[model samples]
Target: MSITFEINRGDLAKAITIALKFAGKERELPMLCGINLSIIKGQLTITGTDRFRLGLVRIRPIPETADGATNPDLDGPGSNIGVLPRATATRLLRVIGGPLDGRSPNVELTSSGRELTVADGETRLTVTLVDEKFPDVVGILLDEMERPIDLDLWGVNTALFAAFKDAAWRKGDHATVRLSTASRPAVVRIGDHFIGCLMPVQIAKRGSTASDWKEFLTSEPERPTRTTKRASRAAK
Candidate 1:
């Protein structure tokens, strides 16, 4: 069967933007440099990950027809997974004009084997899908995320937190990260539809943080045992 689904043009633009965050850099992994697009049981999902960070967005399709009918174009079973090149995603977002475009039309995405066609009105983008098997996002984003993080310090690459940058929803939406332990990857969640994971650095000296993650919060924060006033007085 063919893979054809209807999604709001604006929403698709945002999804592409969010997915691009986790995409691999050029030459890092040729296959992973694109957004992993998958349709499971007719539900579409967009994913990007470079091992260090992972981002996933599920684009809820526009509701079916008023009379209730499935997409006629998807009558036969075919490949439900495809990879959209990162360059294609960015260009498409430009074509879509972000999430707040005045014309929020329905975008049709049709994929057959390694070919994908994205069409909205007279604008059409045809590209060859990346030939690669994407990491199992479903398996990665699983129960490990549910584990609550109980620790005084959970050190992760701050860069990983920026996964939410220019996210489809907003530039910086509050995210809740749960890191069970340094050995495991931390769950980074932003809102409902968007979720990801950030792995903590190995703990060398501390057996928790691989690097020397100094606690800047220290140094007499509240009572201030060593105050600037004291330093000035001693200087005199």
Candidate 2:
């Protein structure tokens, strides 16, 4: 069955922007070079991964039409996975997602069989699905994790990217930053809205990576405490 829905352009852009960090560029596997756009139930999920790092963003439910009728073309509460070209999707969103007539633009995505169509106002694009299956990005993000840490999503992104850049300079292009996850895959969360994971690269690990994290926590006291502080207080 075909699925069709309208999405806020700003939301779509944010998802795409985050996904681009993990989306493969000029890769052999076509599926690896695209973002996986899925709508399960009413939630819209965007995921991208290069097997080393993965990013997932879930937007709140897309709105129904003013008359309160669910689009009949939807395929119920199953996943509608569409692998879209990252570069093309990014460009499309940038052009059409900006303010339209001084108001936010909303773009419609229609999936029928193997093709996905995107349209905003007079601009429309029909992209054929890559003839490959997208890897399970969410599953990879959740797997092999000993601890989940709460951090600002933007902070994680900035620190990791900087670390990645530094590692590449000192080590090689295949370098990785050690996420402070107790010798396991590092998973980070920002409330319920976002989650990201990065695999550890095999190399001599660095020390004192926790100092920046400590400072981050000190600055933001509302972050969920990993330990039972209340229990400790009662014991004391």
Best-fitting candidate, scored by TM-score: 1
Clashes of 2: 0
- What are the C-alpha RMSDs, in order, of all predicted structures? 6.4, 14.9
Model 1: colliding residue pairs? 1-76, 1-77, 1-78, 202-210, 203-208, 203-209, 203-210
The reply for model 2, stretches above 4 Å from the true place, is 66-76, 102-104, 145-183, 203-236
In model 2, state the lDDT of residue 150: 39
Q: Compose the digit string of candidate 2's lDDT tens values, residues 97-156.
A: 656675436677778887888776577888776667888665565464444553322223
Q: Which stretches of candidate 1 lie over 4 Å from their true place?
A: 65-79, 98-104, 146-152, 168-173, 207-236
Q: Can you give the lDDT of residue 227 in candidate 2? A: 69
**Model 2, global lDDT:** 0.63
**TM-score (all chains, Cα) for each model:** 0.75, 0.65
Which 10 successive residues of model 2 have the least lDDT summed?
163-172
- Cα lDDT of candidate 1 equals 0.72
The TM-score obtained by model 1 is: 0.75
Q: Who wins the lDDT comparison?
A: 1
